[model samples]
Target: MYKTSTKIHLYTVRSQMRPALLLSMTLFSLLMLSSCKKGSPGSVNDPGTEPQPVADAAFLQVSTSELNTMAIDNKNVLWFAGDNRGAVSGLGNKNKNVSFVRVADQVKSVSVSDSRSMIIKSDNSVWTSGDNGFGELGIGNAVSNGNFVKVADEAEQIEAGWENGFIIKPDHSLWASGFNHYQIFNSSYSLADVVDTYQKIADNVQAISVGQAHVLMLKTDGSLWVCGQNVNGQLGTGNNTEQRGFVKIMDGVKAIEACSYHSLIIKTDNSLWATGHNEYGELGIGNNTDQNRFVKVMDNVSALAGGRFFSMAIKNDGTLWASGYNNQTFGITGPDQNKFIKVADNVTAVAASEYHSMMIKSDKTLWATGSNTYGEIGAGSERSLSVFTKVKLK
Candidate 1:
């Protein structure tokens, strides 16, 4: 009876061991099936999903060569200017320079359609390169460049001076580079300073302009602010004292532009105001005597552009007016008169170079005048033009 009991116990243990082994193998098979499903072709492991588009993808659409300046229109199309050329195109990822459609090639200065983008290069230094040779790059150093380098980020607009760079940040703050000979950087302005005062304005700025040494800022609320080299009375403060910090210039200002040594402001009433270095009568105050206060140029002015030592404006009726240095050497010779005089009609847009000028008509046709030594006026010659001549872009 004892032997029989032992044999039965051994058989029971063997039976239990077999069932446990089967259970382990079943679990292992299930785990392997699950892993295979996870990596299967019809499962979530597929790798064919399209990439999401970038949020500001519109900026990546257009292809511009040696883009020295850029502006976005009301339709979001991008207009860009090169070192001596310009182009307009719909925003996209196309890389064809042929589709860029050149506007001007010998350009040294450029401003945007909505008055938001400005680019300038003078004295063989690209202001946007942050090359500070003679303090021209505005980064407080004199570095050279083999190609264009973006010196700042989040810049909504930019303007260039003889050796300085000015820009409006996306946050409506102002920034300046180049020379600070007159404390344009405010009280802390210095040749070694790199911090831009727009970060200290304590308010949001709508627009800003930089003259030879002076700076102008228009606030969102229609208030005007001025700072830096005021010796020429460009600050419009009614005093000759140089402003080392931001001061109110005036109110009701809609737009502002700065030339070589002067400033132009447009009021909400459509009147134009100007001040500073008028040795050439650039202020259009009817005289060459310098004025420390803002003086009216004309009423019903719609748009204004300033050159190195001259200025131009368009009236609401589409007539164009120009003032300041119009000498044959400077390239402005439309009318024999030097003071603010009417030039042409049906003008749509105007751009000013160091000593040259360009205009686009209502028909999308372009015209230019002044110094064409480098074919900057696109008149097919190096001759200095004195009148508005049509430019063929075909």
Candidate 2:
């Protein structure tokens, strides 16, 4: 999680930058346990306890990163932040497990970041919470708000950026607010200021994935666009130039995932392509060299995710594959950093962070691995999990 202060804390455990990134691709992150045991929260124990309630097909959505890990349960509700008012946001007690709270009816989904969270109900009315220092919440002012506030009412999806928010309206138009890094919001580039209110940027947008310093937008026509910092060519524009305006990166792209300084896209052919920082070979292209243009990574990918310096993908066979930054998060060793390694089977979805990972299995149960410092992994037990463990969700 980003410190409310101006400094960023590094989680050496995973050897990567910890942004409120990942667990945030067209799904959510920045979510909280909507309900907890009525009394003091207890340690989330593992195994041989109560059987996990079956996850609903409609509520398979899950995301996690930085201090808060959350999901939309079969009942259409889960965790939340700021309830503890601690550095990472949560039930506040780092030692306590999570809980769920029923959301108002018609609540479609929620997205979160380091300090703020945004919810889009069925009515498309947007509500926000957390730090508004830069007005990322679009609450009409820069006042830092800890409680959820009604910000915008539209239709469609939303994503929380490193310190901003990306919104897709009912008309398929794109809108955004907060830190304007490299003008990803489609205006003058300025890292020193922010757009306090949501502003429209484009039209015919299908989906968006905001990374730590860059963003990827997928158009309704299957073309991909990018903007922002590219010191490592994350934009895949054939150069490392900072893009102040959205530029076409590729086409026939059916899905996209972005993280700190890298990106991955799935072509209509089901082949995977990648670009950006590869210091840890997170691109899964068999090398550590960064690419200024999208390079083929593999074929037969159904879904993908990007983390600090690593990536995860689900194959057509329901197997989970991972690569880069050799950490326990991927269930592989340092020697496997440059290549994709099968991590798990019968996996349906996965979410990652700089030091942890979360997965939803075929059984609809939640499982996690890697660091649990902020209980981001929330596997019930607070110890660092080198192997994926079934999480006991109340």
Candidate 3:
């Protein structure tokens, strides 16, 4: 048996700059117990004694939108910040030189879109905040909200896209609302009539990823399905055709990610594969040619993420590798990276948006790079950064 004990502390820091930039921070202290290793039944210590839980590791995980960032610490406290123009509320500010402030409380997880945010609280209820243009907030109407509003109950996971919101129920079923552009909801509903409430799509879903106009989901049996726009073959259906409903594209998939016009998958064998727009070699296939079918990129990938025109992966050794547009958008200088290039080591988790990227180290410290327009990079300045910089937290 496995168990977890966690402690969460909220940290809010505001930039010294006028009209302060908000940064949300969560300090997670976790205690975890590993499952018992294989051993002879009568060779181990007395069965009467319970195994003690271990404090081996803890780290942060982050997700980003076009304008905001959200993070879940080891204790499941979700912290949020960015685009304060009525984009998100429940924020606490600090008068300091820091560039981040903590917001929200008792959150278990979070996800963001271009202008909206969603979080699952400890009670298993889901809440939404920010832009609802097209009903992305999943609040049962096409109304925008600046403050967090309860949208659903008994949610297990949540995600937001360009203007769409998605939630997974306790039954491993998928649900969504918001913009119907490219038929993201797998319905013939016109763009003029967007989904207002969380509508059911499919069941037995193990994971779901939302892109600008496309969406991907993984079934409990390791099957991959995709729907929506395929202008650049982002659906990986071996063709450039739009899909209104879920279509099986691959199997044995362990993880998946999507953004803008591309899709990525990590198989059970720890191999990385990609499909869709490669205008800037975001596929990391050693060329800028687009692919309609999934193509192998590398192996030994442990975790993966994709930006608008770039993708990032972490190896089993804790090293970070990236490919695709290498311009300022990639947080690197010089020519574009057609093949995976080692950028950093000891990275535990990563989150990528259209123009900026944020990562967490094994030590639980956060780092960011790429476009800093509006200080979304959490570097305390509007100037873009081409190299990773540690975000100072209070």
Candidate 4:
């Protein structure tokens, strides 16, 4: 669900490394800490790195996609996508006080994986750059390009998966490219089925959430459909069998989120449902057992964000709750929580990554918590935080 009584998910990006045999590894034991940036090969969780200064100004808006966090400063300056060193761009970095690198002009939104990035210009055109091993850039070839290339037009929304890209048109049609190992296209995605360009896959789609190897599609009719890997019952199809085609899993769904091996579903009735990988209580069901079918979790939820093995939910009353994989990573001093724990209130939005979590409060102030191996937490240092620390936007 866009916000759910259920859990939500975000894919586990390989960071700086991309492996072609991701599916060959065990889900519970895999700890891929890869990167998309070009310069660093150090441990993503390294703690000895020197601290860097960070800008902390009020923001008008904040957004997080995958491992990137971006915000528009109150002054209209665009901050670096939060993955790179703390830098802001746009407005030409007029303020010599801040080092800004202009990414693009007239940009509306950005989506990035560990190795590639896609930008939607204000004119409704989609551009892509970086790794294109599977033609995820949608530039009509598998050759990688460092510069952004226009890939599609008249797009309404874009999403970047591990090595895949998706676009939604004004007509609500879903277009996809890149890896299809799990058959997100509703057809056999054999080794020869590498899609080098975008192709229409479904229609009447209102929203979509991509998981490590699965996808959740929300239709205008409130139907939720799923495809891709289900080794851990992530597809919520009531079995561990993989789905090679779009299969309807539930109805009256309002929003959905997918990540790594779990999914969160919000119903039109304001109820939450969760399914798939729950080894660490990512499902927030107060237990560590796995679920093959969609199970009810909580209610009164309005927003949701799922991390590698944890889940976060926001109540309509403005309270934010978190569960699963709670440790020093979440700044909590207890064992992993199988149940939801109240963390903060007045939260408006939140984004979860494999290691870090970013959120925006009602005041539009940004806060981040978790691992900071790559200075992703923007805490002015490479030290990991044990609490939701306020981060400056400017």
Residue ranges of candidate 2 with Cα displaced over 4 Å: 1-59, 80-106, 142-145, 186-192, 332-335
lDDT of 1 at 147: 29
* Number of colliding residue pairs in each model: 17, 15, 5, 18
Model 3 lDDT per residue over 1-394, tens place: 2332333443454456333233112211221111122222323334544434223223366887656677776776665556654465334221121145556667888887656678889999998877666777777764553667888988988887667788889999988887676665555576567887888878999999988888899999999999888989999998898887688987899999987899999999999999999989999999999999999999999998888999999999998888988756544576788789988888998888887788888898777888766556555556778888776643
Against the true structure, candidate 3 reaches a TM-score of 0.80
What ordering of candidates by lDDT runs from best to worst? 3, 2, 4, 1
C-alpha lDDT values of all predictions: 0.57, 0.72, 0.76, 0.71
Q: How would you encode candidate 1's per-residue C-alpha lDDT over 183-214 as one tens digit per residue?
A: 55656557565542222333588887666567
**TM-score, model 2 to reference:** 0.79
lDDT of 2 by residue, 1-394 (tens): 2212222233333436344443332123112222222111442423344535534333465666565665665555555321223222322232334433233445567766666666776667887766777767776575643446677888588887887888898899998888777766554546577788988888999999988878899999999998888999989999988888788867899999987888889999999888999998889888989888999988999988767888999998999999888567785444547778888999988888676777888888777777776556655445677888776543
lDDT of 2 at 173: 91
Question: lDDT of candidate 3?
Answer: 0.76
Residue by residue across 229-344, what tens digits does model 4's lDDT show? 89888889989998877888788999898978999988998888899899899898989988889889999999888878888888898888888897544545667888888888
Highest TM-score among the candidates is held by which one?
3
Point to the candidate with the largest lDDT.
3
Query: How big is the positional error of residue 194 in model 4, measured in Å on the Cα after superposition?
Result: 1.0
Model 1 misplacement above 4 A = 1-127, 134-145, 151-153, 178-181, 186-202, 328-339
Candidate 4 stretches greater than 4 Å from native: 1-67, 72-77, 81-102, 142-145, 186-191, 329-332
